[model samples]
Target: MRNLVRYCLILSVFIMFSCGENTDKKSGENTVEEVQTETEIQKSEKNVILFFGNSLTAGMGLETSEAFPALIQNRLDSLNYNYEVINAGLSGETTASGKNRINWVLNQDVDVFVLELGANDGLRGIPLEETRKNLQDIINSVKEKNPDTKIVLAGMQIPPNMGEAYTTEFKNIFPELAEKNNIALIPFLLEGVAGDPKLNQQDGIHPTAEGYEIVADNVWSVLGDVVEKE
Candidate 1:
């Protein structure tokens, strides 16, 4: 009877230990799942800053990291701003092409929309009216998708090669749209780096990597005011 009682007590302890181990494993699994859920929520909560433009925004002829948009991302990250910078730049992308592509780009949520087209259009000497209309349409599309999306128009200028009147009109498109739409504007996307040979690449159009740092500054000057950490 003593041996039987001792055996029963050991069996009870073994069952209790097994049950406790299983409970601990289940608890660990629950904690892991909770952590994963929190991480996913954090990812989904990050706001997007879309830089839509042509070669300049695409960082043509340089590493993607050297582009102004990426530099802007670095600044945002350093400032603890929870924003994702999407470089929707395409080489040789004109205002009309950008308008056509805007819908696809807007599939994702955008908090700040930096419109950086018209440079290519101006360079190509596309009709000022067409450029203006395409830009307006693009802005309208963005507004329609999300009225609250902050639009920052990047003003561009081309050399007198396009003729003085055309150059002036092309440059005017940006500010006019900004005023009409009541959105933010970057007076000149290539303020200090435009004519400087050192800042530009061999093509004399796109900025060099170092030049992009200044370009990033130009963007941030206006963008900083629009993007507030929420």
Candidate 2:
């Protein structure tokens, strides 16, 4: 009789232990689900970082994730920056076109605006003075919408085919604007990626994925610095 009682006690203890373990497992799973939901909600609340430009900003020959803006987003994620990125790049957008489109883009709240337009203008022989004025107007418009919004202008250069006068003037527009507006300026958007056949696609204009990574590094140099100041 004592032996039977001992076995019953042991069986009861084992069942109790098993039930306790199952309850703990359920509690752990609920906690994990709650944490995941909270994380998703927090990510959705991040501020907007709009990348405005042409085909390069759009990642023409590469996957959307491979684009420099997306790469910047990834870097921000890794660095724990609470900003959401929006790539407002079109395949052939010029400075004039950008001015026309800026109003629509500004409809959304933007915390940081990175302008990369004007390469197409230079390539198409558009007037440098006109390009500069259009860019200034765009900056003014953004300021009108969000007075405290930070601006980062990406400088671009066309081939010497456009002549040294136009090319030099085009290159000078960015720094001049940066100083006048007191905004951040990326000296050259194509720093390490330009003129390298290995970095560019067959068109010799759009960058490959590898090239975009370098481009991101270039933007990050000035962008990271200015953002800290902002």
Candidate 3:
């Protein structure tokens, strides 16, 4: 009888320990699964931004990876913001060209659009009214496709040599369009680097690597607000 009792006690203890280990293992698996699910959810909520413009947006004088849009992507990644930036910058593209490509660009899942066209138009001395109309249409088409997508219009100033009246008309186009469309606007895309020899490349038109930082800062000042809301 003593032997039987001892055997039964030993079996009971073994069974209890086995059950406890299985329960602990299940708890740990549940915790890991929960963590994975949360991470996926966070990833799905990330924002997608599209940069549409000409050579400036393409980082003509700099490496493809050093473009302002790429810099913005790097910054967002480093800050742990789940975001994707699409670079739709084409070399020597004008507002007309941008309008031509707008529809296709809109096919992507864009949450925010950074409009930076019209510089080439300004350079080519294209009619200001035509530039304005093309830009308006682009903005309208983008809104038609993604009504909720926020827009940031990157403005450009004509060189002073373009004549004061013409320059004023070109400079006024951006703010007017932004105001009318009720979108965010950056007054000057070049900002501190436009006339600075140290910041510009040999052509004096495009920015160097260091100059792109200033341009990035100009866009970021307006973009930061929109991102916060997103």
Evaluate all candidate structures by whole-model CA lDDT and list the values in order: 0.93, 0.92, 0.92
Instruction: List model 3 lDDT by residue over 1-230, tens digit each.
Output: 99999999999999999999999999999999999999988866778999999999999977889899999998888887778888899998999988988998888778999999998888788989999999999999999998999999999997877788889999999999999999999989999999899999999999999999989999999998998888
> Per-prediction count of colliding residue pairs?
0, 0, 0
lDDT of 2 at 94: 87
**Model 1 lDDT on a 0 to 1 scale:** 0.93
Q: Which is better, 1 or 3, measured by lDDT?
A: 1
Number of clashing residue pairs, candidate 1: 0
Winner on TM-score (1 vs 3): 1
lDDT of model number 3: 0.92
For candidate 2, lDDT tens digit of each residue in 164-214?
888898889999999999988999999988999999999999999999999
User: In candidate 1, where is summed lDDT lowest over 10 consecutive residues?
Assistant: 221-230
Q: Which residue pairs does candidate 3 place in steric collision? A: none
| lDDT by residue for model 1 (1-230), tens | 99999999999999999999999999999999999999999988999999999998999999999999999999999999999899999998998889889999999999999999988787777889999999999999999999989899999889999888888888888899999999999999999999999999999988999899999999999999999733
The collision pairs in model 1 are: none
Give the TM-score of each candidate. Answer: 0.85, 0.82, 0.81
Question: For model 2, where is the 10-residue window of minimal lDDT?
Answer: 221-230
Highest TM-score: which candidate?
A: 1
Q: What is residue 110's positional error in candidate 3, in angstroms?
A: 0.4
